[model samples]
Target: MFDSIKLRKQHGYQAIRDIRTATVKAPFRGFPRLDGEKCDLSCLACTAVCPTGAIATEPLRIDLGRCTFCGECERGCGTGAIQFSSAHSLASTDRNDLIIQSGQTPESFRETAIQSRREIHRLFGRSLKLRQVSAAGCNGCEMELNAANNVNFDMGRFGIEFVASPRHADGIVITGPISRNMAPALKDAYLSISEPRIVVAVGTCAISGGIFADSAQLDRSFLDEVPVDLYIPGCPPHPLTIIGGLLDFRRHK
Candidate 1:
């Protein structure tokens, strides 16, 4: 596949080398490397599901450029071998330099999300926090998101947290379809969050009502109830994507 001069010229030779190096070297690198702890390195779901066979078990490597980060491997792994990290510092000058996985546990990841939430709250000088509402969701999205606050994802890492009271929140995170029964509650919550604040729609359901589009009890659009600053599109996006969206908002503000 490397024979095309035009393609090679467009991407440069160094970029390709760096990508290969990252894939070969990544599996050997341990998590918490700074602490001298080694990853179990026992999980191989990424190898099995990699559409292009970019991941391999014998050498334990991943071709960065070829990786889709679809979280298929992470989700499929029963042992949590492949994981999402709060570390988003994967940018590189060379196209092939992106082969490493940060391997952050759900615990560390949540901690970072919480920390960001708190910082944003503090910046507003508000004692209140953010509220999360579920519309006509399959419960998978809600469960995954709620899981972040448990010991695993640890939403407290970023100082941002979820609150039970809408009045206390600076914004609202809505997940799933806007069920007819929940419409009033969703609207009330959106209105309760203080003004100059924002709303975030998570998952395909909240954005487009998703698979429940034909359900008589669900609304077609959630934006009708609240102004959304962000729309995360996924059946249930990985927790990292949700965190990334929030952090992006933080940076923009």
Candidate 2:
């Protein structure tokens, strides 16, 4: 007991008191900032090296939904036109908002990415129980989702939790790119949840299939079939991003 007490004192308040104001590590990649004017007319380097076809010239846009956050675009750009910032508050209700264009900053873009919904708050104001489905996920998003419940993040304190069964869940959180083999099961899980349920697409894969968008084995048609309440964009979204997104979803009404 004495040893346990000593350890407890060593790590006081492991969880973040306020996720909204907390800052992620400088090395972590959350959002991409584009600078189209910096590019030379002959250069198409960023687009050529992009694995997910997320980059497009003319106006210069980087789709956060398809980005793996690998920072490869930054490496490929010699003019420093594309850079990734450490801002982790990357969640959106609309898919189109995930596209980052030239002259946009993460801080500025975030202002319009999320919106207040009365129905969402009225349903899940106090407590929200979610069932996570990894439809052919690489386990990257799954790991981060698990970390949201750890001591450091402690998402449960805000009345959010991941339940074992879909029947007991208030909503479903979908990860991965949704493979052909897993599509049916994914639909079944959504059907299993009770009405007034919400759906959150987490990570780049779930949002826009990431690098696997064009894979023959993947099937992302499920998103089109059902309405998604939230889209959390990241290669593997940070725990803070996941937690903050969820809280904002339930709050701000």
Candidate 3:
């Protein structure tokens, strides 16, 4: 028991005291800030180096859903057209809203980010149990999702957590591009869960196939079969970003 107390002091209170308003202090690039005036149509430098084609020039919009948050565009652009910020609350209910247009700051996105899915709130009632499907991912996003449930994030305190079985879950959290091999298994997992279920596309791969959209090995039929309730945009979204989205989706905020 004495060892436990010492461990507690050494670790301190790791979880964010207030997940809703907590700001990330690290050199993490959570959101991209776009400047249309600085964007040069002739150069097209940003688009050329973008691995996932997340950036488009006509209206100067960066789709967060496809973004890996690698900061490649910021480095290649000389006009300061794109700069990434530490603002991490980048989840949304609508897929279209993930597209960040020029002159759109993190603050601007926050205004519409989580529109409070009232019906979901009524269905879940401030608690959720999810079954996560790796779907042949690189494991970066999978590691981050595990981190979301750790002592530091402590998402369970809010009554949100992952379950071992789909039968025991309120929904399924999908990561990675759904490979052709995993398609049938992914469908089976979803079918195991009860109705009034939620589907969350938690990373760039699951949302828009990330860097593998053109790859022939992916079969993303499950995405078309059901509507995604929340879209968390990041290579692997921050733990705060994930938990906060779940809370906002359930209208806990």
Candidate 4:
């Protein structure tokens, strides 16, 4: 007992005290704030460099659901018109909310990001069990989702966790583009979960097929067939974004 106590004290508090208001440091790109006024109409440098067609010119906008947060758009643009901030709390239940326009702040994006459903709060505010489906993911998002349950994040403490089977889940968290081969399995998993179940799309690939949207092997029909309860955008969304998104989605107040 003394040895255990000594070890515990040595490590101190490892997890973030608060997920909602915590600040993420440099290198991890979160929100893309676009400056449309500075854009040179002739130059499509940002658009050209984007792998997923996530950038739009004329009235510049970025689709977060399609974005990999690759930093390519910011780096390739010579006009200093784009920047990716370290504000990782970007997640929304509405697909249109992910389409960020120029001059939009994280605060503004967050204000209407989630208009939580009363039924959702009633059913899952206190506890949420999710079955994760990788679909055809590269596993980057899967790894981060795993980290959300680790000692540092401790998502399970709030009663949000991933289960081994869809039979035990209240919802399904999907992490990849719905590939042709994985479509049936994905549908099966969602069906296995009881009613009042949600569908959460995590990462750019799952939400908009990432760079693989045009791929003939992908069958993203599942997204069209089912309504997604939440969309957490990133190539592989940060664990904070994942946990924070879920929390915000279930908050009634």
Candidate 5:
């Protein structure tokens, strides 16, 4: 009984230390604030809904990394203490370095992600330039790939301009199973791209035919058509992951 009490006290002390550490290392200091008098909002909803516990009272702040960029806090804030900025340098060598302060609202986070995609597109250049073919996919991967170019995920930022003709493309983005029916089309697409090209096999279906592993109709081989530069193995990888893979390709080139 005495040992149990001692262990409990030790855990309590550690918890207090953690809180203290977080307080001292808090990233947002002197972030801008609205004139509460000028704005007649009565509720502090941001404080209640922040998923990461990144927001604070006394003066409002946000740790960007802890934030999922989900915009929940901004939506919850009635006084508009939280906001988004187009600052996408949320990456860091140190994991803790991604914290940021915008003082904007949740609406801003959406704008920021959009703006970031735009910047990525601009940097990558605006040319309809890649051919994508799915061999034996469930369509989920294709939907996400399409969404990257849609208004929300906005894949055009990395200059992921899709092309209808393989001859006009710089690379091939493949998804789905390498079904026998699609094999000829996939091979043709790979062959049609110019030299110094790339192939990205997206989703587990394209990589290994996923659930269709034993199906005789599925080739179960991405390499049969062309040499793959990147393999994104997910049931259907997120749009951001697709973008990241493209960006990584750019870095290598």
Candidate 6:
């Protein structure tokens, strides 16, 4: 028991108290920085190498919604025209706002990406329960979301939790590209939830289909059919980003 206590003491405070100021480790790409003037107009190497069509030249733009947070665009560029920053707060209320143009930084993106939702705060401010639906996710986003509720993140302290059923949920969080096979089930789950519910799309797949956007098997038309309140962009968003996005959306000033 003494040895266990010693180990616990050595671990110190596991949960992060302030997610906004927390720093992520190196090489964990979160946001892209694009410099249009530095790029060679004749070369389209960055776009060619990108598995997803997240990169585009002609003034250079990267859509975080479709980005997998992969560093291929950075490695493909010879003139250092593209690189990634470690900023993880990439959630946005507007889908078009995820596009990063020249002269934009992740620091700047945060200002407008999240807007204060007074109506939503009034509904689920003190307590929020969510139902997670994985349509056809590769499980990468699912794993990171699971980490958000672990002891290290301790999201429960804020009265946020994932419930077992949609009937008990205050909102729905979706992961994956919404394949045709899973569309009906996903819709049924959404309809099962009580009224005044919101929808949160997590990961590049859920937000914009990531690398699988072109896949013929997907039925993302469901997204057009229903309203989405939040869009969290990343190949697999960090736990801090997920927690911070939720807190920022519902927390009172």
Candidate number with greatest lDDT: 4
Which tens-of-lDDT digit does each residue in 5-73 have in candidate 2? 999899887878877899988788887878888976478888889999988888788888888888887
Q: After superposition, how far is residue 197 of candidate 2 from its true place, in Å?
A: 1.2
Which pairs of residues clash in candidate 6, taking residues 3 or more apart in a chain or in different chains? none
| Runs off by more than 4 Å, candidate 6 | 1-12
TM-score of each: 0.50, 0.95, 0.95, 0.95, 0.49, 0.94
- Model 6's alpha-carbon lDDT is 0.89
> What is the C-alpha local distance difference test score of each model?
0.54, 0.89, 0.89, 0.91, 0.55, 0.89
Candidate 1 lDDT: 0.54
For residues 54-122, what per-residue lDDT tens digits would candidate 1 score against the true structure?
355444444433443455555565655455443332222122322343443333433332223445444
State in Å the error of residue 238, model 2: 0.6
**Each model's RMSD to truth, in Å?**
19.3, 1.4, 1.6, 1.6, 21.9, 1.6
Q: Model 1: which ten-residue window has the lowest total lDDT?
A: 28-37
Error of 2 at 182 (Å): 1.6
Which of 3 and 5 is ahead in TM-score?
A: 3
What is the per-residue lDDT of model 6 for residues 1-253, given as tens digits with 9 covering 90 to 100? 9999999999998888776688898788987788888989779999899888988988799998888877988998999989898888888888898888987887888877888688889999889999999989999999998999998888888888999999999999999999999999999999999999999999999998888898999999889989889888888999888988898888556
Predict model 3's lDDT versus the native. 0.89
lDDT of 5 by residue, 48-107 (tens): 775546555544455542343456666666665555433222212122322333344323
TM-score for predicted model 1 compared with the true structure: 0.50
lDDT of 3 by residue, 1-253 (tens): 9999999899887887777888787579988899999888789999999999999998898999999999989999999999999998899999999999999888889888888866787878667899999897889889888998897788888888899999999999999999999999999999999998889999999999999999999998888878998999888898888887788788844
